[model samples]
Target: MNQPSSEGAAAETQSGALFLMAMLALGTVAPTVFWGLPVIVGQIAQQWGFGAAELGIAVLGEVFGMAAGTLLMATVLARRPLRITLAATIALTAAANFATPFAHSLALFIAVRAVAGIGAGALSGIAMSCLSYTKAAERNIGWLVLLQVLWSMALLGYVLPVVGATAQATGTYVCIGVLALVFLPAIALFKRAEAFVSAEADNSARVDVRGVMLLLGCIFALYFGVGVLWTFLEQIGMRAGLSEARVATTLVYANLASLAACVVMPRLGHGNGLRRWAIINIGACVASAAALTLPQTPDRFAIAAIVFIVAWTGAATLIFATMPRVDTVGRYATLSPGVLSLGFGIGSAAGGELIELLDARAAVGLACVFCCVSLLCYVSLGRAREAEQDALARASQS
Candidate 1:
């Protein structure tokens, strides 16, 4: 791979690594809070003397805060240099986590959670921006997706359980706080890369409305569709008459397969190859959707659906991994996640409401519709990229 040999590249790479590590650390915290909260909600309510309704409201406040933070970070990173913004965001997120346990009242708890969301969103945006400044810029999408998978797996596999076992939310918060501190060194490395900039900043790289719209569509359809499985995976297996062990195994297989695919997808191509991979993924989703609705049988339905989940995850990895490579990728790298998060939040909310009206099986159909929409977006992106290439080639020949 070609890389700048300037004193800056070395420093930037170090910073890039730190930024990624911080992202993994900070991202895990938010998800942990969300997932772990339900398991411990009763304990929390009893200790604080709050009812279930209040707890639900506190969770909502946190999510809203997080969404706002992401939007604000997207705009901020577009105008400012990255290192300063990155470090500040990390510090803010860490502080938010540390303070989460100290909220004595429901209102105070809700307020803190919202603040934490902003910090988390800001940290995520800066981390994506930092990736654009490194040697890995060309493969930025893959790296970001991989980091997300790793973070998600780590949190689900380890962190939440540890926190639950501790019976104290403080330990989990501190683990992430210490992690935020580790990111400071990475910021120093990023400064070195900025000092060696050779070309003027590309001005045409502002967020593209069409590109962002496509990404939003993908997020909404994919996340909302997949949510049916998320909200009812265990229930589905039980309803199908499978043992708990089988359900757990299926979930593990699904996640592990996706993680492997995300790591591999980015390495498969340098040009529009991601587009091809995306097409294959769409097929996988279709198959999975069909399998999900089939009559339960040990030999047919259960196994096929399990395979389908694994396939869908791999397909999702491809979609997410290709995101950072969009036309104005460098620009969107910072903002795309926020826009995408908005899609996810909207999708989740909408999907939940839709589920109230439709059964889980019907919800799978909704997911299929979402997947089809995402496929169209990918097709559009492919055409736009081809046009851009043709124009560049013509200019070069002249």
Candidate 2:
């Protein structure tokens, strides 16, 4: 009897798999509530009478927890059932977010946010794993990026402001908690999507551990630069004399630019062009960081914001897309989020300290340095991969 080909089985499950991917992607970004916290950290600090360092500590707690969760998923939980993992993580995240509103002390707030991060990290790992199993990672990830941008626009541009305006930090946490609950219904779809992985060709090929490590290093450095800028972007704008509202408005345009990139990226196809695009994106990021260091005029700041978002989104999506190709088993893909989160945690704390000790310009300078380091790591990884492929071709020919 003829057996169904892997490609044929994949086609059969494509629609359901994509749907599950979308849910997981959405779950992946649902944790952006933590990202948004920096936007209102000033208000929280004033309410609590905490300094920049203290606020940073709180943020670091959540970031560490997220990294920890991702590490667990990539290692210990790697063999767990997707459906069970997703459900358990989402439930825990929702509970932590719900409790965030009640945290009065700095210690309590940090603890709860850390708890939320653990759950969020696990969810992100599951999402990345599922996405890695798909036939077209770049296109699917582009779609995921678009979903994330739209969600961010809605939450940051409207919901958080409106709700937080009335109830302050409490209102923000409440909205995040409620939003987390919305994903509970999506958990069931994971079961149906399990077939996507089963249908994949048995890639028993050994992974290039050293090469993947370099790539992960690049991811960490790239996001570290991003974390430095992103965590303090609004505050930096205000320091440059823009009103809070103006900063928010500028960020809206940035998000829009990111959305446009998401639309365009998938159409570009997954090919050698990915590396070229990555190079271009990193250059743009460095340029954006440099521009931010210039005089903070409205026009200059707005343009830089747009440039940063477009470049960052494109680069990040490419990294996510490229990881599956690097390690077919999705091991690196599972670890990518954790590595990026760890970078973010370190960058955020370090950026905050730089701002306090030196100035905003110093933080921007550090970000540029991180981007350059990332570029170097990426170039090395590319060379290693090319050599490996060439060697494999030679062996086959012989």
Candidate 3:
């Protein structure tokens, strides 16, 4: 048998590593706010004395701002210089995060987070576009997915744990701000968006209009559930008699669940097997949410949280993995984030109002419904894909 090289693997090579590292940096930071909401928002509420409704509204503003920024990049800035665009967004993200600790007023904080969201959203749009254009987009995307899980683990696990122990939420923002700046050095390695465009100009790259739209809708619905659950996850744990420390630690373990999903993601590929897994993910999500409806126990809470993160990872990966099956144009995949963010913002805002008017249980039930809606959309997308394949096959036979 041939022995593997000392370098470990092909993707671990210098040039690939450099490019992936740069892209990985952006990918990790892109969804930090969304993924770390439980920790960050929990800290903000503890320190700032903001009510659930107010914080939920603030989340809505920030995520919608991110949606706006991503949309702009996909359209107006499509032709812009890559390095310049990425550098500017990175700086803006850093500035916004650093400024967050100063937003004593609700309005001020909303504005600051919106700024940060816009910057991060644009960066994400560009990065995904770049990834889809890679020689091995699937492999690169798998690594990118894994990178997000690892970074989130650090954010929810180590960084926030130590820094958020005090009465200050400054550590959360400051650390992320610093990491945003860290991405600046990676800008030089970024090729222009145009450079990533595939040289093979084939009709197959064209998007299936109906199929892609279903995907966007599915992404939106899935993230809506995520937004509702994730926004109040820590708070929910508190309601369940879990301490903040325990809840935070549980999130770290939950990230491990997401990491496991990412590793298993590639082998699953896309089709019936993938859809079956998606159903299991949905079941776990609903089951986890239902736990909050029942009496809250520590072990139960831990189990639910782990399952929730698994569902989160699975829903997100399903979107990415399903993209090529539906469309290769690359444009739709970039837009999915904005759509999901919009749904997330709406869900967070709605969940907050529900929490204020009703209870966390009510909000969680609603979130479960959204997850089902997402599943239906997923089913529709799969059927659309089959229909397209059938049409192509018929045309070929003729």
Candidate 4:
């Protein structure tokens, strides 16, 4: 990754609003696709009469592609020029998306979507690298979260009114293809006054490979919980005797309310305040998971689900923020997306298996356990970081 000069890092604080919007849009499209898979797959199933399991496999393929693509951009392509790199990636993704609907066989469709995922993941890698250059990382990332939710809402609105299931669906690939083309021109705006992470910087800060792995693992587990919770949401509602309409309506409002957490947390400062709130939010996720799975009326389920989203939104922003602070070299921050996306894929698959093996309640239990793992990992990361910083301070004084 290109490390910026001290001058460039200082300049990052004053980035224009237009640049922020462009970057946010760039980072969010991949997440929107990941989160919207259910609807996309559902539409494909309706159009092609594909069975459930086949579509699920296709979804995994795309997600795996995304993970691979992000890692490639962040590492091998890290030295590539920004504008040209983004243009190539965006074009590749759009081209793949346009080709998606033409696939007649299961294998071919997955292959096409996987190619698209690679491009999309490359876009995400570049976007995250750009965003890290800014000083207001959490706030900028908060806005990204806001955009992702809005896009997800739009996807749900677009997909549900028409038709859908999980990964293999994409009757709307053409729509996403069009979106990629629109973003293609915005690569110009991605350029910065201070170039992103320069490999030449001699800053003595050593890369904490162990800490980075821990954080990456935490991200994976957190998303795994997210997968389980999302998988069983409908079943959770059904058990509460709620209609799908009611569940959908509740989901909308819950995400809408979640917007506030994204707004409020960043403003609270990113030191002790961030640490304190992160712990609380993770705890809330654990509780929400339990509340959803445990026997409950419609009211209880609604409340738990709402809190679950709120915690997730807040926790997500802070979790990403941790990367730059942990690995100042910026090497690991770039790889975080690959791990994060991979986690979501694995988590979703695990949830599906748990549901079949036992029941929705069992899936919910898995979500709770995943959340616990993430929370514990987060705590360890915090303690290790503080110890390192303290030692650095002592050495500087001596």
What are the models' TM-scores? 0.79, 0.85, 0.79, 0.90
Whole-model lDDT values for every prediction: 0.59, 0.74, 0.73, 0.76
| lDDT by residue for model 3 (260-287), tens | 7877765574445666676666666767
Worst 10 residues of 1 by lDDT: 1-10
Candidate 1 Cα deviation (angstroms), residue 262: 2.8
Which candidate number maximizes lDDT?
Answer: 4
Error of 2 at 46 (Å): 6.3
Q: How many angstroms is residue 306 displaced in model 1 relative to the true structure, after the best TM-score fit? A: 3.7
Q: Score residue 373 of candidate 1 by CA lDDT.
A: 75
Q: Indicate the worst ten consecutive residues by lDDT in candidate 3.
A: 1-10
Per-residue error at 48 for model 2, in Å? 5.5
Question: How do the residues 278-308 of candidate 2 rate in per-residue lDDT, one tens digit apiece?
Answer: 7778778889988999889988999998898
lDDT of 1 by residue, 252-279 (tens): 7766766676566666644557678777
Please list the Cα RMSD from the true structure of every candidate, rounded to 1 decimal place. Answer: 4.4, 4.0, 6.0, 3.2
Error of 2 at 137 (Å): 1.6
Candidate no. 4 TM-score: 0.90
